[model samples]
Target: MSTPESCIVAGQLAELGHTSLYDLLEQACREYADKPAFSCGADSVSFTALRSHADCFARYLRHEAGLQPGDRLAIQLPNLLQYVVAIFGALKAGLVIVNTNPQYTAPETRHQFADSGARAVVVLDKLVPLVRSIQPQTQIERLIVTSLDDWRQPQEQGDAADETRFMAALAIGRTLPEIETGRGLDDLAVLQYTGGTTGVSKGAMLTHRNLLSNVLQAVSIIKPGEVEYGNEVRVSPLPLYHIFAFTANCLASVFTGFNSVLITNPRDLDGMIADMQRHSITLFTGINSLFVSLMAHPQFDSIDFSRLKWVNSGGAPLNLSVAQRWFERTGSVVREGFGMTETSPVVVASTGNTPYKEGFIGQAVIDTEMKIVDDQGQELPAGEPGELLIRGPQVMQGYWQRPEATAETFTEDGWLKTGDIGVIDEDGFLKLVDRKKDMILVSGFNVYPNDVEDAVMRHRGIRECVAVGVPDERKGEAIKLFVSLHDQNLTEADIIAHCREQLTGYKVPSYIEIRDDLPKSTVGKLLRRVLRDEARAQVQP
Candidate 1:
């Protein structure tokens, strides 16, 4: 039993006994005050500037918004300088953060707000309409609307009726007393939501210790490859709302004094390359789809990859072809990791300059223990595929407000039951086998078939729909939809357009097939497995 003190005394690692994330951020603000903390387009926020701005925002949250400690603040915005500010500010104000995807539809936003019982929301101006339409259905009261122009200093503010200005909050925060965040390590810091097998999003209650430990664990494993005294410049194209990016790129970068570049849309390979070349980024965090997109780009080889020290991929399985091409194009290996929201999103990761291997997701990270278990809760032998169970300081407290689901998600001794089936090799490497749930993966984003089906079925013309992932050369898996329509006149394009409005782009089905009827069980329940097998059969040679 290594005490937190002993761990710190044993070696040089970031101390994990802080009261909260704000405690760590306050320290970083003092140590790397002048360094670039986060950047988006032409706007860059220095560590010192970030602290001051967050202070102002926190004061406004506590005083103006009337939000008290432990109150949940939902942040719905893309990767921008404002996203970083609001995250730190919410922590400084002793509020729990519920990261909402900016691309979420109105119904999704409503569900998250209603489930989390969020009182305040900071949203993008373009997304305000969605929030506005759903506010009546949720507890959301305080509305803070910002724009892309708000990344820096906006010359003219947009017309937002009954909504507070983001810059205005910062200005008011400057005058109010500094927020005294009285949070303990055991206090809830974030409510990271992930869709269950049922397609209903459930929030994972993550305490400060959970996240702080994960950050320290990550920092220790990656320390060997990091530049001396935090000279690491990281390029982050993934959404910060995702737990993987939140920990790896945002929190880790701030703690270690890395210059973090925020890429809003990586689909634009030209823009992404331009930013990468501009920063001479040393560390890259992306998914298989992103890596493949960059490698296939015309200007990808033209960019300098000599400074690229490491490339970390997660969210989806890394294909050998993409990894090989990435290493050949850039002089860096693609190290893959595996995790879930309940584990603070990191369970296994390749560390240091270790030779990257296909199929394997590296050894368990620092202070993290994992095992393979059979259905009877018995441990499996090495090289045997079973449900992967994880126990670590980084594991979440459990699903928020869902005791039964939480109980079912963990073993009697408290190991988190990662729904992923995996086998651990004799050398302690973990290789995934399959997903126990019928969840679909599209471009590294989890797309629950039920969620997509539910959205499509909302259309009056659609009687029944089935969503499944099919093999994609660019994305590891792309969604294909099978539909039985009440109105035969409805075209695939019509249903797709309807779905585009209801779901995010990634979750939208790329291929649609008209079906007379969908396979169903004797009890009249939709047999998703039957459809999945049929789809796989179609793709087979």
Candidate 2:
């Protein structure tokens, strides 16, 4: 058995020069003034113009909206140019950004706004009614709404007492004097909320140091792979609200100067493909399910993938079958990485030069330290899977306004309890097992869902699959697998027979169900919790 010191691993450290996100943005604007920074559909904005617009919005927030420094501002919208403007503007005004998912329900939206104590909200016009229904219940005093095409034309203020169009705010802001925001690295930058798969979503209090360090760490790892500064075009299909995209795509762009093509509706395969053809993208960021869906598109093969340098897979586990299919089609190996909303999101990643490995998730990223520990909080040796603990500059300060929850999430020595089960090899490569909470016990034997799901997905007929444990009288818990198949002729018996080849007796699924499509999040991560609840309900009655 190895000691704790032998088990701990650290990545090469990277230095962060910028004090805050504002400082980084200003530097990018100065260096890449005329370069295109972002594009949505047919519209594009240069770095200089982006800075001008952000300044205008920041002035309006300070002067007209009466939002003071350190105020909480909830930004609820999809992937749009307006999102970039709003986020940068909020940072410049010294406001803490509360990124809200456009796909969230009214209740979910209200909880975030109310919990964060947000005083103002910038929401999509289409979802205005949902916000209005719950606005009175929240602390939101100022309302800023935007439409899909609002950036193209002037917009009028709404009839509501405090409702102002997003365009109108920028317009009003341009007339005000430049306001100085006295913010630093220690100040809170964003209130990034968790997925709430376990319970109520808690906002992870991310500081400027936390986020900026991550961007630098990512740049240090990626630049050595020959990714040019200020030259590459990154196709960003993931939502910016998710931390995976927030830091990796948006914040990282300020430093790398990559022109990001925002795909508002990734579900629109035709539109996404058209944009791919138009941008000649060099970098791509997406999840496993999306890779499968994109390859399934008939026109997918038509796009030229020669310029594609990197295809990053995060937000979900990377399936070996899907990764191979992507590599075969695009001639680019999928660089798998792991992160969460808490760590400013980039703890470990496979660099551009790293060779493709089936189940390996690379190593701890720059300045990050990682170790595996047992339930007793004692460190585990190499090859032994346990809860992964992380300590890094990118780790969040704490959960917002929840001391008890925050204390429970961290150890006394300050390592963030990642709640993920992973194994670290002697070479420091990590293979994620599954979420600690999702582990199943079958007659005193531990069975990981990822082991079963990965085995099930290898079958040629299976399209997508999720494994969850359900209650059983005989075994205490039984494995239940849900799958969507490419071939309708394949039977549950076939899947069972296939699993029997790779998985142990207790690990093999006891129940199998065929479905047309499984529940998935907006980012295309399989909603195992949702399916688990449904499966458990069915078994109960």
- Best model number under TM-score: 1
lDDT of 2 by residue, 1-541 (tens): 0112211121221233465688777888878888999999999998889999999999999899999889999999999999999999999999999998776666668889999999999999989888888988899998898999987875876758899999988888988999987688778999998743344568999988788878877776674757888999999998898898999889998778999999999879899999999988899998765787899999999999999998888876666777788999989988888887888898888976555455789988767889999999999999999999998888888889988888888898888987889999988889887666676655434466776787788799999999998866435568899999999999999999998775556678999999999999999999999999899899941
Q: Which residue segments of model 2 deviate by more than 4 Å?
A: 1-17, 195-198, 223-225, 439-541
Alpha carbon lDDT of each predicted model: 0.84, 0.83
Report the lDDT tens digits of candidate 1 across residue range 221-282. Answer: 66553664357788999999999999888887888888889998777788888898788778
Error of 1 at 372 (Å): 1.3
The superposed Cα distance between candidate 2 and the true structure at residue 209, in angstroms, equals 0.3
Error of 2 at 423 (Å): 0.4
Q: What is the lDDT of residue 349 in candidate 1?
A: 87
